[model samples]
Target: MDLDEARKLWHPEPGWLNTASYGLPAEPTWTALQEALAQWRVGRNAIELWNESAERSRAAFARLVGVPAGDVAIGSTVSQLLAPVAAALPPGARVVVPEVEFISNLFPWLAQAERGVEVRTVPLEKLVDAIDDGTDLVAFSLVQSADGRIAPYDEIVAAARAHGALVSVDATQGCGWLPFDARRADAVVVGAYKWLTAPRGVALGYLAPGLRDRMRPDAAGWFAGGDPNGSYYGPPLRLADDARRFDISPAWFCYVGAAPALELVAEIGVPAIRDHDVALANRFLDGLGRPPGESAIVTVDVPGAEEKLERAGVRAAVRAGRVRASFHVYSSEEDVDLALNALAG
Candidate 1:
């Protein structure tokens, strides 16, 4: 689907500028969720019906990031999925992260300090230069949550590779509207609620073959079993042979809603979404007398901007003492104008 056709899938209000916080669900996604809830209310079919949604979402996300579905894993949150990696790190290993990185990517490595694993916090610009033989892992957000500054993906990945450091990216802020090839990093994780527009319980990740071999599936359950249907109760400890081994037992209804949302994103295409969102962001930037920014999420230091937008019925957020207004494929020129007018007023 083209941008024009895909824009019809959502019905966002005229002044919603908070896709960076959480995305409003598309019509098909909302409908899929409502149907699943209704079915649950009456016990309509079975778990298999809901489970199919997880598989569909998994395959769709895999296509969006250019990796095999078998290489992707399902989980509830970024930190939860990364806990095993943190635990498995050899004692005294050093990890490099940006000082402003969201805690989901930071806390996991910070927790490793008990074992003498050093977690180095550098400015985003210095993050690439920080990688050396001493750095065992380079972990960060692809897009900063506070200011929307995009990370230097290719540079950081290259530096990590040159130093033999594993790269872990929290793409939660960048994925749905940004084109990413997950294979570039050892582990690329996303919580789909914000930009992918899935339910809160949906998180997806790609784990490279080499990295998958190193981490245990700490949250594994029946879903992680080699034969989930046959191994309802544990005994032989049979887990999946691929990245599926890292799976966390899913929240069924969440996956039901996620399937249609992620599939629609795939149909519309990430490169197209990137163009649509960034164009709106640049328009907002132009109105604010600032140059265009690469990210759909933009931050400005207008005093009382949050309160001003609130009075005008335009929804936005304040982060790091700046108003963070994010655009999405569903956002409109009218929405951008409303926000601009509110701030100017």
Candidate 2:
């Protein structure tokens, strides 16, 4: 979809600019959720009806990330999806991550400490150089959530490959507005609420064939089976042959809400959305007399900026002691000016 076409489908009030914390749902996503809830409230449809939406969301996520549908696993959260990868690590495996990385991508590896797993946290700028022969995995967010710095993806991947280490990316803060291809990493995980515009309970994960083979499907249930509908009562212990084996039981309502949002993102196309978001972010920065920023999320150190924004009815976030303003598909140049005017006042 074109930018204007996609913009009209969302309903964010003017001056809303907090997509970094959570997404504002589009009209289609809201409608799908309401319809699903209405059916549930009256018991008008079977619970299995909800399952289809999860599968649809999984496929849509796969398309957005440029991966085969079978290579994507449906999940409820980033940490939950990363568990198997952490479990599969050998005792004393060394993982490297950015010091200020979002906890979802860091905690899972840190939790492996009792198993002799060692997590090395370094500054984001040094992440690529941090990978060496001893590093077993290099995990980091594609975009920093606190300040919106895009990772040096090519350098990081090259460094990891040179050392025979695996690369895992948390795309939670980057996906919908950042153009990326999941094939570039060993594993890519996305918590879609922030930018894909889904509800809070859904996540999408991509596992390379080798990574999936190393990881155990410890969380596997009927949902992970090759035929979930038939595997409910299995003694056969059937699991999907690919990444679906890593699937967790889905949150029905979340998927019902996620499908349309994921589909909408795929239809709008990330490159176009990235242009729209970054242009607005640049507009905001220009008005502030600052250099243009590449990422859609911008952070500034104006004193009391957070309080100023709040007082002006401008929705944004305070992260790591800076006022973070994020633009998305729904944001416009007007939203950018509103925030700039608030900071000026």
> How do the predictions measure up, each by TM-score?
0.98, 0.98
Error of 2 at 61 (Å): 0.9
Which pairs of residues collide in candidate 1?
none
As a whole number from 0 to 100, the lDDT of residue 102 in candidate 2 is: 92
**Residue 16 of model 1: what lDDT?**
97
Tens digits of per-residue lDDT for model 1 on 148-249? 999999999999999999999999999999997789999999999988999998999999999988888878889998888887974988999999999988
Q: Give the per-residue lDDT digits (tens) of candidate 2, residues 1-345.
A: 887888899888888888999999999889988988899899897577688888899899998989999899989999999989998999999999999989999999999999999999999998888899999999999999999999989899999999999999999999998988889899999998999999999999999999998988988899899888888883988999999999988899999889999999999999999999999999999999999989999998998798888888899998998988999999988888898999999
Q: For residue 326, give model 2's deviation from the true position in Å.
A: 0.3
How close to the true structure is residue 92 of candidate 1, measured as C-alpha lDDT?
96
lDDT of each: 0.91, 0.92
* Total clashing pairs in model 2: 0
Candidate 2 Cα misplacement greater than 4 A, ranges: none
What TM-score would candidate 1 get against the native?
0.98
